[model samples]
Target: MKKISITFLLVLISLIAQAQFTFKGTIANYSNKRILVKIDRAFDDILIGNITTNSNGSFSIPVKDNYSGIIEISLLDAKKNYIFISDNTDIDFSASITTNDEFIINIPGNQINERYQNYLNYDIKKNSILPQLQNINFYYNSKDDFYLPLKNEIQRISEMNEPDISEFPFLSYYLKTSDLIKNTEIGNGDAISNKNLILDHFKNAGQQFETSGVGKSLLYNYFKLSAMGATSQKDWENKIDKAIEVLLDEVGEETSRGQEILSATINFLNGYGLVNLTDKYMKRAESLTCEISAELKKTIQDNNSIKEGKIIPNIKFTHKLNDKYTYLYDIKTKYKLIMVWASWCSHCQQEMPYVKQFYENFKKSGGEIIALSVDYNKEDWQNAIKETSWLNDSDLIYWDSKFVKELNITGTPTLILVDQKNKILKITSKISDINNLIK
Candidate 1:
């Protein structure tokens, strides 16, 4: 009996040692029903789990055992507002949606996240030059007047936060990139000269940041900056492909770091409607030992499905006004514009007016518009439709709808142009492309 009792105690202790951590938090004014918990896997975001939030906006997500790293908890509705988690630590915090500044995060036991919050609070308080910086288009033209002040401000912040940022790879990379941009020499000349200098600086910085292992977001920004010099979409695609090739060669495609950079590059390009380059990059990624993520695999499949001549899969939607179910294939018209969007998407909201105007012209030419909303809340979806001209023509699918998954819709305002037979003509996120299709 004594021996059995000792064994049971030992087993209990072992189980306790391997227990997973719990993360619980409350978000005020956030009506989203679900929260996505993702861990940073190289340059990709691997979905760990989804937590169902209570009606009062409180959530609890369990961190699986043996996995300890930086995790991002994002509300399904407002993905931009993410709560960063570090280590396998428990966190309980309350954040406000109305607050434009830093949201208060109260972590009792975790020093890493506490430190991060402190740094974030400090940066938010000190970032006064962002508005001024936004006004200056540094890629199109160099403003010497804007450069000095921006450079000084960045330098000042780096100096002030050196102690706090040294331990954080993401913050360290950010400071380093800002310093590099500040120190770069810009020559006064024609637009071509200015663009060349900008591209050169970004390319140089991108090469350096590619190896940093800090995070994908910084590297993505660098790639965007580097591609800004391209004169057209085709030119941009060529430039980006060349840049990727150079990067792969420099880092060695078989290396983990090289695969990380490649993965991020592929995701960035795909997000910008650059599906033409995805196949080439994806094939290169497959050659590497690193396992391709399910999300990427789905993306590759989706890209293939919507290629120029392929027949798009039918999208079934229940109309918001009458609750009548309709199929995309059933809509017989000369041309059909299937727009996947959401109420929370600022870009979608901004482009709706123009889309309406284009639809007016397009309808006259026997074109049909099917505006799909992926809003989570029924009330929000209805309100969005009521506010816009889309009330008569809109259908709601909410989040992670079958249509969204089938179409591989990542970001909103995704425009798909189809012929009478449901054959896809063009797939783009740009509003200006609608006019081209009409013409």
Candidate 2:
């Protein structure tokens, strides 16, 4: 019994030892003092570790069991190198910052990485011919006329390299799936026919190659393509919802990939100001059996706060000119335009004039403007106000303001429109589109 217990302990220790991995590399002409090692986790890049290079420009990063999948080694101002890492493997590579050539990888007795390096070399050679192929476009009159020759050239290159891809499953899968996506994107003729082709490619590729990074990217692109088929906003919402359903069915909801797809879809809907659809999708995501990431959960919560039809948070601020505190609810107008701006934002500087014009036209129709400055320095905020004649009622609050957190103001020049009862109506960043909302 004593001997058996000792053997079991030894085996457990060996397994644990095998789980750790190391990556060491040397950079030629390495100007950067530190190198960052990041692991690609679905839609997010997680920083696993960092290494300060020695005087000889060599660095080593020890990757724990927590990191898997694609690894990226980023050198400051230099091109990044990507590699697939597994347990117990020590991957060594030498990269040159001056050249665009592939890194010289040395993973002793790893056939997969060896083949990958060879494939990368071949791919680089193929890419070198792309400029010449693009030059073939001079013969064509228009972009529509150039598609056939370009497609033919792609087919020729794919066929010529068939032998090289025979042993590499991942590369083969990437090439075929990429070709299918390309065809779906460039397909000509009737809109219905194009839509059918896109759907067919998506359904087929998504089912067959739903396990890799490339596959996830293809599926995401498929969702974008599906959105293009919609003729109206209502149709777009329905189509996007159906696409999400199909994706959830293809890749079960209890997976990282599934959560990534849901997060991306929610972000897409949010970008277009489709608050209703975004909320619906967020609810669907939450209802799933999968573990929701904290970041994604926060995103859903923040978006819900400013979603249309939801009441705007009652925020009080002391008006800079009057030095009197005013509640947002006290703003007596049929509609309120809250413009979040900062003195440092160049985009805000450019859009201020258009916003001024919109406010002039809008205030005449029972609308009110509240120019809120998020600048940390009170003097800079005051000076910016002096430059503008249209800003009458302005407030200043640094980033620490509770209203900033409630609104989730990520960038400057954000426009939020609310009705008299403080019911959120429209939220957008495009200041020029304020006319559409007022009208």
Candidate 3:
């Protein structure tokens, strides 16, 4: 019986191993261009990979079969339409990749549906208002249009209130997103009505699955919402501290990929400048980040990347001439100016010549310029690099790169100057007064 049990366990492991697949394809119809692709694991932004295409549009990528629930491939074409990949495998491009093309891939009945097929098919359309709710511009512009979609969705689910509906894992996710949107939008909207609805839903959702693993994850979201919803700065600070305490207490109980959520929550806390809330949690976050950094270093060893200071995450790009991959790293000089820009941003375009002029003088006086492009399109990034002769590395990367987010850069034409060791010489100096720094 013992031998049989051991054999069964071995077979289970073997089967899991065998359920792996690889995707290989070519991206063509361009003389010289870079491509960025994001392979999402179903609903969440898990297991993301950014790759560049060769000059001739030939490319290949490897993804975990289990994680590649519904692959989304977005191409950055300046004159052409974006490319999206939404299927399992075996990709072959059409003969021509031209500008006037509408290209989008749709994968129906995907893994999300497969896994949760047993649950009733809840129409995600009502919840689709999320993208708008999340859009900073839209949310600010049309707060009236920003209805409580999550609240409605949850109410629908709660109305059923069966073991299955209540037990569904996605309920917690909806609740969390709803909570975040509400808290972020609180005083900015019809305060009394919106805030009350948010608070009520927050309590209702928490009570439903208070004892589940997913509920544990919701605690972080709950505290995050509380932090953002506080009436005053003092209120916000205290709520954040309380949230940190709760997070620290429950940090150890997470299982599976819960550690990832834990790390992200900590990163959020750090970004909000609430690190002092819980020293123990701060240490845990730092330790986890260091561990993840070590693993990333091993995985990304070629680049002169290091885990020190507040360095941005390195993004991979395929060399134009040679299809080999390379990551852009911040080269420390006597003084360095880091410009965060996007091709689509007019302000960024307008600021380029001035930045270039600054570079011309600064280099002479011992300074360096590194412009990081946040263009979602790979071709646009390459095109912008060619059009603008800024004295900087041409290794254009995606905006979704962790570096941009780490720097807390939500606006374009934002600049940061650092010393030789990359210390903050200046946070963001005026474009006109930038030269004053070195002088």
Candidate 4:
């Protein structure tokens, strides 16, 4: 019976206008590198800007005029990212990649970051060493000569705790719910042995932490692991229902917080490829005595929109890829490929040329490629499609376009294959897989 605060259901997602601040840094060995700055919005990221290091590997960029909180730095590759908290002070840091490939950051004149960095270093060490030691201990005989010292070291490290920098209130709460911490029995490769513990953590973690990106990850990972542990599909479905029941227990059923939680859970399931579990959420929401909000209901409806064998909504061609094809349904082709792409995504750019090359063959088979751009800028969308004559259009709403969410275009270059009736035949990211489908 832990307390779960319902303030905003997202404290970090909404940018607060704190006193202006900037983050100054130096990256070792990577000079003049383009970096992607993003702020956490629950499970999603709002792109801040692109920054590049100077020749000396030094860079300075203001966090944002009205934003201060959790930020992600994607250096070069999208995955080689690190997190930092910017406060009232000008934070300075020096960073480099470790031999083990962990991003090692050290911020001077900031005890909060100092403590956090120490914990990251410590966590990486523990993650690297402990599991192997666990296997050794599992395999070796207790009477072995190496057992005593190895066991003692393992015990000491396991008992050791991160330095208490809880004096910084927000960070203290953040660490509690962060993906790096296993107090919730959930993280990468963490087995969900205790479902109650995760629910308890979600309940106990305050509004600020529980409503952030870390919170979303915990819930997503919990469901993923739980789904794996289920004895059967029926068992999995039951667990999903039971989880929602416990989370909503004794809480204000009519409140938006409950609704937001349900919405987030549904999105998480969709992101995790748990299509069947997503259907259950709408069922649960609809059957409830209290009226579900339009937003929540819309989320459920959108998720169900593009299921396999479901006829997708017919789209008007605002900027038709082919001048001959005025609407999505107007195409006389036997099959269609809905290429949901964005202009800014490098991966999408790479995929476009291949898609263009494949279009002729696909068209010969009575299949047409309908390019749907998810760009918010009309000019950008136009520039991107200059080379292709596919039947296409962009709402210019980025991801907020109704169909983008409905069709579940989670990333750029998502290919949705459908028949003449627009019944979704296949949805995949790989171009090679769908090549066989067209033939």
Best by TM-score: 4
Name the lDDT value of residue 396 in candidate 2. 36
lDDT of 1 by residue, 277-394 (tens): 8778877766656665554456556766866789999866655334543667777789988888887889998998888778777888988777777776566776777754432343
Structural similarity to truth (TM-score) of each candidate: 0.60, 0.52, 0.50, 0.61
Tens-digit lDDT string for candidate 2 (232-273): 978987887787777667655565556556776676676666
Better of 1 and 4 by lDDT: 4
How should the candidates be ordered by lDDT, best one leading? 4, 2, 1, 3
lDDT (Cα, tens digit) per residue for candidate 4, span 137-219: 87667799889888987887787787776676756667656643454344545465455556666555555652246756666
Scored by CA lDDT, what does every candidate get?
Answer: 0.63, 0.64, 0.49, 0.69
**Residue ranges of candidate 4 with Cα displaced over 4 Å:** 1-19, 58-60, 64-68, 97-102, 106-109, 122-162, 179-193, 224-229, 250-253, 272-276, 283-336, 340-360, 365-367, 370-407, 411-414, 417-439
Q: Which ten residues in a row have the lowest lDDT in candidate 4?
A: 1-10
- The residue-level lDDT of candidate 3 at 69 comes to 28
Query: What is the Cα-based lDDT of residue 157 in candidate 1?
Result: 53
Ranking by TM-score: 4, 1, 2, 3
Model 3 collision count: 5
Q: Over the stretch 43-150, how does candidate 3's per-residue lDDT look in tens digits?
A: 123224555566665666655464322344555543332322233434444333546554422221333333233232333323344343344333333244534654
Clashes by residue pair, model 1: none
lDDT of 2: 0.64
Shift of residue 10 alpha carbon in model 2, Å: 13
- The residue ranges of model 1 lying beyond 4 angstroms of the native Cα positions read 1-19, 27-37, 44-57, 75-79, 95-102, 119-215, 224-239, 255-257, 273-299, 314-336, 343-368, 374-380, 387-405, 409-412, 419-421, 428-439
